[model samples]
Target: MTATFFQRLGAVVILLWLAVGLAACSNFVKGGDNRHNIPLSGGVIQGLRNMGSSPGQGMVVRIFKEESVLEVWKATGAGAYRLFKTYEICAYSGDLGPKFKEGDRQSPEGFYTITPGLMNPRSNYYLAFNTGFPNKFDRVHGRTGSDLMVHGDCSSRGCYAMTDAGIAEIYALAREAFKGGNTSFQLQIFPFRMTTANLAKHATSPHLDFWKDIKEGYDYFEMTRTPPVWDVCEKQYIFNPAGSAPLNAAGPCPATVSNPALTAKLQADEADLANKAEAARVAAEKKAAEEAALKERGAAVNNFFSGIGSGIGGIFGGQGRPEAQTGTTTTLPTPSTQRP
Candidate 1:
């Protein structure tokens, strides 16, 4: 049961190749999840859908603070979402958990959508992703929070904040949503409190009702792993299995958000982010180049002065004459006895 010499050599070579392949794989996977530059966009891409110039298609967004992730998913057809992409929220508020009502100063838990599109375009902040809150669900379930958005306010009062660069990518995803027919999308902003560990930690709060609703939403997400539809007027969540109830006399439960003016505002906000990003990038590069040149010039000046010093020292010390120096040098004689 002895193998031929050639056969053994082939086996050894194959083993070496396999080892090399595995090492390469290990290295490649080192930054596996983090390595993806993820295009300046977020979520899964489906070519079946196209983004039109207007934002009217149904958009669904999920914010998992626990994961520090915000994903944009676009509804292509019935029961189908082409995930636009995911973005990292650089900073979050208070505890890493869902917001409960007004003044909690925490990011709200449960489903909500953008109401008015108005944004301070001239904001000194990087950029804002305004999620119209207090939609039917928040009001009905009696949750509260307003002016909630994903913005460049790196420090958040109640909104999710990302860095200027992070918001730039988010702006793109939001714009794409509008263009792809997503006039409005749900924004589910929860703290990192959705974990089983987290739920157990806050299990005994007097505000347990609020947390209970959030947990329901979170569990629905865990089971079906889907965003809930905001039952506009009811101000509560009509879980998918529960089905949507008939609208009351209040002009449709989830008041249809027909704010064209708001849509325009969102578009403007997005444009502003794109412009600022480009400008900042250009300025940074210019500054870097200028700094480099200054360093080089400074070095050249130091070398020139050093050479002059050497020439002068040489003259008085019986070294090479100044004129024999390879680099340029100048000398000035000491003033003769001042005025005679």
Candidate 2:
């Protein structure tokens, strides 16, 4: 009956209530109509169904830093992913390169995964999910950083920021995926679209090789329309349709079976890329040869003129220059020579 006892009881009740709220927010039921009070809008639900995606299904996220775009792809009943939506990124930090260390202000560019446990429903940025940075590849290279995220508020400091409305839709999509029994979803971040043209444009960048490695995964998804089974080995990425053998973060890559379809696609792509590169190289060489020939011709013409001029000068005993310089000159009167 004392006031102190009443206050303690009230504190316990408040703590319990908070715990329950958080639990509810984190736990989502498959095909559930409500989401811890923040139910999906009718429009969003309708949109998903219209796109042939159910309320709860698997999803994948792809981010392109150069374009400042995020694409959401949802799995269809046919076992392939279809593009669900594309959201413009409000802001992201750093330039087109992977985050190397803490305080680099660089947004990470690599394969990351978002799990149900990583969701932050009580985010200060309205809503967010941890990017799971410093992944195996990052750590293998001794890279360091932390707390990178995709969130709202349209501001960034080594994170991907989106509008509050954008985050709401994204968060809901992820929640539904989890509810549908997807424990985790892939998040593939890239410096730009991994096209042959784009790669060639940045051929001289220091990250070219790294980009090429990531492009394998990108191309796999593009071709199969499914998230590629990826694994990291000896600081490199390995992908296959059958998934990789228990990958070691720093150990050698286990022998993996190549999917025949993927192999054929990659081989064809490589041939195309090689042809493009060779053509570029040949064109550069031709340009250099033409420029060199033009310069040689120019030098020869100048030499011929010099020979003719030399002969004329020699016949005149080099006297024309002195004659040309013999014009009358007026000297100013010095102060001492002037009439005072």
**Per-candidate RMSD vs. true structure?**
25.5, 8.6
Worst 10 residues of 2 by lDDT: 28-37
- lDDT of predicted model 2: 0.85
Considering every candidate listed, which one attains the maximal TM-score?
2
TM-score of each: 0.47, 0.73
lDDT (Cα atoms) of all candidates against the true structure? 0.58, 0.85
Enumerate clash totals for all models, in the order shown.
28, 0
Residue range 289-328, candidate 2, lDDT tens digits = 9999999999999999999999887868746455445565
Candidate 2 TM-score over all chains jointly: 0.73
lDDT of 1 by residue, 214-285 (tens): 554555544443565445333334443333465442343343334354345435644554565466667778
